[model samples]
Target: MKFKIRKSKILRNLFIAIGLLSLGNLISVYLIFNTAGVEAKVTRLLVKLLNVNLEANLPTYFSSLVLLADAILLALIAYGNRAIGGRFWHWIGLSLIFVFISLDEMIQIHEQLRAPMEALFNTSGLLYFAWFIPYMAIVVILGIAYFKFMMSLPKKILKLFILAGVVFVSGAVGMEMLGGLHAEVHGEDTLTYALMYSFEEFMEMSGGAIFFYALIVYIEMNFEKLRLRFKPKKKKKKIKKIKKNLIEA
Candidate 1:
């Protein structure tokens, strides 16, 4: 027997999930900014990434810039995908795009979150994900646009999202295994650390992926507007021609 999901409940669950995730993330960010102890560490990382040696604070321009660019790129992507078929291959392609971005996000989160922990141990050469926060924000913003606006995704998008998760986790493990062997020989915690990093990244990205999938599904469920925008050549003229041929026949 085939499984069928209800549209209304899916829509409800999706929005609820997005709301909770966004709220939780905002609270965490508020804490990061408000607390002095975490604030300094976060500032130091930001300064280093921006390469600002002067005694000035970080600018809000970073966010505005990312948002501006993300808006453009997202609009382009949505417009570009207006008429894409909702098929297995198409699903795979979309999944890969999300996965590629998702993996990059995982790597970035690992770098960013690991910095503070590394700093706790006084690891001097450690680096932080200063600009990465903004970059990730763009990804999230685009994700929101993808969900809210662009409504064209494969059937069973949830399954495709899960497939991407499996692939990413497998790749992460494989890379770490090779490094882990080396770490064992060198008497280092590199493998363990890498695993910890991957896990952290996975946690952060996994929720975003689900939100992303739900967004795609939402858009797909409303594909008529999406279709009219996409299928320009198959409009009135084509219908007129078909009618003329039928009348003659």
Candidate 2:
């Protein structure tokens, strides 16, 4: 059997999803802040489901699924490159990183570090959410280690990868740092903080979608068509019974 996928279609759909999610988040924020009277039960439910700032919601699930998709794509590319043996480890390493990131996105493992890191470093202001410190260090080390691998990739892929990384980091770390500063001073229950987090989530989702599109393009360029087939096992003939009957005769 054969299956065909359009890279552009996937990209378009991804952007559409991101746009809808962003709109939903904005609506939830407006309903929460702008509405003066008591909110309806349905409105509260909508806020719970659509709020980008809240965890275990639609936005969180989408982000986690996007990262998981990236991990799967990276693993597929790594498997394809394994035959040629060039930068196989690099591809696999990236796959593992995405896998961890996907899990962290869902479970928020990094959030656990915030308290310990703050206590250890006496962090405040932009560093109020101190979990990013360790993550930033890891990113720097990985970047240094993967410098050669990045340079070796095709120009188109290199550019896409860098763009994805920039967008993701800007949201996951940069805007997060700014949000932390705002949160520390004025607290988390403010319109500005909500908007900051909403933008941050949007950027993160956009980055993942971009990277997923890049992987689809890469697969199309390098692997051509991905296919799957199924075949039934053959059965052996029963000759022993016939031979025994002939000998008895």
Candidate of highest lDDT? 2
lDDT of each residue in 1-249, candidate 2, tens digit only? 122588889889999999999999999999889877537888889899999878899999999999999999898888777644545889899999999999999989999999999999999999999999999999999999999999998899999999999999999999999999999999998999999999999999999999998887777777654443233233212466667789999
Report the number of the highest-TM-score candidate. 2
Query: Per-residue lDDT of 1-249 in model 1, one digit per residue for the tens?
Result: 112456467446644643453444334344434557755776555433332111121211222222233333334335435445423333334454554553443243444544564446433211222323344465566567556223454456555545544544443443334434445455343434434333433343333444444444544554434423445666978999999999999
lDDT of 1: 0.42
RMSD of 1: 18.2
Give me the runs in candidate 2 sitting further than 4 Å from their true place.
1-4, 37-39, 225-249
Ten-residue stretch with the least lDDT total in model 2: 228-237
Q: How accurate is candidate 2 locally (lDDT)?
A: 0.89
State in Å the error of residue 117, model 1: 18
RMSD of each: 18.2, 4.5
